[model samples]
Target: MGRNTRKRSKTTGGKVMAAAAALTLGAGGLVVVNVYASAHESSGGNAVKRSSQGSSQGGTGQAAASEASTIDCPDVGNGLRQVPDQARAEVDKQLALLDTQISEAYQRLRSSTRALQQDGNFANNAIMGPLKDKRVATIDRIATAMGRAGDRPQGLESLAACTLRASGNQSDTGGNQSDTGDDQNGGQAGNGPVAADFVDITTVQPNVTAPRMSQEASRGTFATQCGVNENKLYNSDNVIVAPGVDNGAHHTHDYIGNQANDAFASNDDFAAGETSCQNQGDKSSYYWPVLRLQDGTEEFDAQQQGGGAEGNTGRILTASEVTLEYVGNPGGKVVAMPKFLRIITGDAKAFTNGTANANAAWSCTGFEDRQLTDKYPVCPEGSSLVRTSKFQSCWDGQNIDSANHRSHVAFADPATGACPGGFKAIPQLVQRLVYDVDAPSLNDNGRSSPFYAVDGFPEQMHKPITDHGDFVNVFDEQLMNEMVQCINTGRQCQ
Candidate 1:
């Protein structure tokens, strides 16, 4: 979020704040592949397993302690829907492999779908049909593996039916055939800190629409003055690495705001920092690990490389623009966002843990009619790549941050989009990340293709369904007051 004082090579960390002291300035910061089966262990592919038991347990599933502690899973009745805990590890291992294979196949289909100009039928016949058949086979193997682990195997049908399918948006009109090989997203190519060679054409998927905000809030055009910019890379400055890492999560994150963000970063440190928010008084920071394409030739900081950091994997390009917006609670309610409040939205373990918390919206800049759920949208030329990560709007009105990082905040009910009992609604902060990556072309190889997908996140990341968001409240008392004032008065302030 700050400027680099000196130029440093890849060997020396490039352009970072000097020594965590710029006058204490601050800044800030899927899919479901559920593997919660009890099965026999099969050693193959990537040895990845996901557990929602929090960072401490090496998974990103819900941090629902109450649910975890109270679960006295009944003794196996022949028809019980749950699998035994003893078989979870082995089942998780096999499911992780399956998750990877399925995601890769989906990626291939998406690539082909775009290459064939949004021809869903063609892509399905040429790619998806076989992939689905293969998926069926994989599911059978997983079932057998789970049965061997001494657990009941009744959930295989759900797993087998969880195939990837993209809805055809009749309104989508293909991409440009031109290829200039120019890096147009303001990122430098050839010998700059930026990674990958971006194509010049901006793929536009017209008629795409943004995800629906909870009905509790209005779909008014009231937007903040915060606008969008390319230089604002939201790297992780203060977040624990994974559940167990002492410092920031094991992997590096692009963060916003200058505050200290880790277990050790005290509230005071969080309060004092430069913010990307237009209101300098507001010190909240937002962030997420950068998503990279694993094109073999890509070079990532040592931390981002897998087997190094918790929650770390892949080498993605820095985002093209980070759009930050602060909206009053959709329900027209406003409460002082309790200080030091932290809430993580989206299930990080959805891809591999069989959890259904993934709520991702993929669209092109102008494609208001064509939208894709849980998958990246292929944009036609002249349009930009866009992914929106929306957060839960309800708060429990009690805790700042929870042990599970999520239980404190719950999503509004699906039917009514309203907060549940004991929960208070707060401002809906949204992070819309736009990238330049596009559909596949004949020039690029599968592994090296410049496509955007979250599949490579650690097996624990729960790919495809893993697009998520994080938030922390460090607003100065005065700024917090202004936010309330704006909401209570129904005046849209930036």
Candidate 2:
């Protein structure tokens, strides 16, 4: 479900603060996980699940920024703003590394799981625990890097690019996007007041009117649909998503942290999955219902298709907009996000398969592509541009070749594709972006990466289910070689 765009935590926005709180077990990790779990269960049994497929986002400028990425910026009227080309490049580099490391850890986990199975160590959990430790360490490294890099924390900036169209980008109707061409520079190129209000909170809103806890702002269709906005959700706030949630945790003005939020994020409890797997002799929590729909031919619904039809919550991942409370109230401006997309579950064959070449569970679903793609300028079909399978794969398990692409990114069907026999499928929500700006022409990619997703726990790297630092480490090492060669030749930034 992680594309260029991701949740700051789990909420769709420009800030990339996503970490599943799975790494290194930060100080507050347990509290958050418990809370998130409660929220998941509370979401109820019947909410219409939708496609996690996201629509096209805004454009990244023809050229990348130089060093402007490190510059400190503030929260706009809400939390959305333009990122310098330098910042985008750095973030992309960081994401690349985190992606790689996590994949590596996952690979190790695979090996450990197998080792455990063969050595009769599953019951002892010795292999699993050690592998989990390694994974957590890797996640910690990613979190540390995020803190060091100082971008929209988490690997979320990419999600924002996917969600919030920078300025000057266009959106399909009802898709919440704009193309005004005005940016931080106050008029594009991020030339204006770059520093905006920034929000950093660890708990749900104590009170709506309590300073950062609450403020006043306009709410529209996008806000109602996505469940957050400049007034509530932020261009840079961390949201949480858990496997199970409890309704008892719901609180007043608690929209941001309560378990009740499960309704909006398209998460469906696996009651059926629990029942089915209960008799299979597998782990109790491993049951997944959406996967049951994999065999149903209703997988491909161009409009309102094959997601689990639970509650009547009808929201599209195609596009949406929400304004967070920008303390300065900078002219009461709103941030526009395009194409919100996310998966209900990350467990898939792609994870089971070490590299991309291994038989994927549903590489055709863009699921693997979403997890393994490199930089942009995808294939002719757009999505393929990020694929690496066109090259070759290696079994060394140490070095990962870029060309080892996922499936046919060029011909993916709608989120509604019927699963082939024996394939596992999960629910996903998709939506487009739309913008309601003060001026019609003021709502496009002001200056940022549409392919970037903002992390929810910008400060807490543990928020992302998968470590984002893995992406950065790999990217830096890869590009650094090129950079070192350029530096030796007296080249600054190519």
Residue 128 error for model 2, in Å? 9.8
lDDT of 1 by residue, 1-494 (tens): 33232211110001111111001001110011122221112212213222233333121123221111110110111112233334333333344444344434433432342343433134334443454466567656645654665543554444342222111111111233222111211111100011122222234244333444544454332233232423444333324112212222323455665444443354555666556666677677676656554343344343432212322333556667777665555454556678767767664444333234555555667664554444445467777776677777788887664423455677765445467899987767777777776543423321124333442233232234455667777777777777766765667666
Residue 106's C-alpha lDDT in candidate 2?
27
- TM-score, structure 2 vs. true: 0.20
**Highest-lDDT candidate:** 1
- Angstrom error of the Cα, residue 433, model 1: value is 1.3
Query: For model 2, how does the per-residue alpha-carbon lDDT over 1-494 read when each residue is reduced to its tens digit?
Result: 11112222112112234232111111211101111121123212212211122112211111111101111111111111222322332333333333333333322322242242343323113322343354345444434544554563444222211001111112212232122112211211111111111011111223212112112221111111212222221111111222122111111111221222222222222111222111221111111111110112332221211121110011111113322110111112222111121111221111111122221111111223232211111111212111111111101122111111111011112222322333222111112122211111112332221221111111111111211100001112333334334322333332
Candidates' C-alpha lDDT = 0.43, 0.20
Q: Please identify model 2 stretches exceeding 4 Å from their true place.
A: 1-37, 40-91, 111-114, 117-292, 296-494
The lowest-lDDT stretch of 10 consecutive residues in candidate 2 is 466-475
Question: In model 2, what lDDT does residue 45 have?
Answer: 26
After the best TM-score superposition of candidate 2, give how far the Cα of residue 179 lies from its true spot, in angstroms. 52
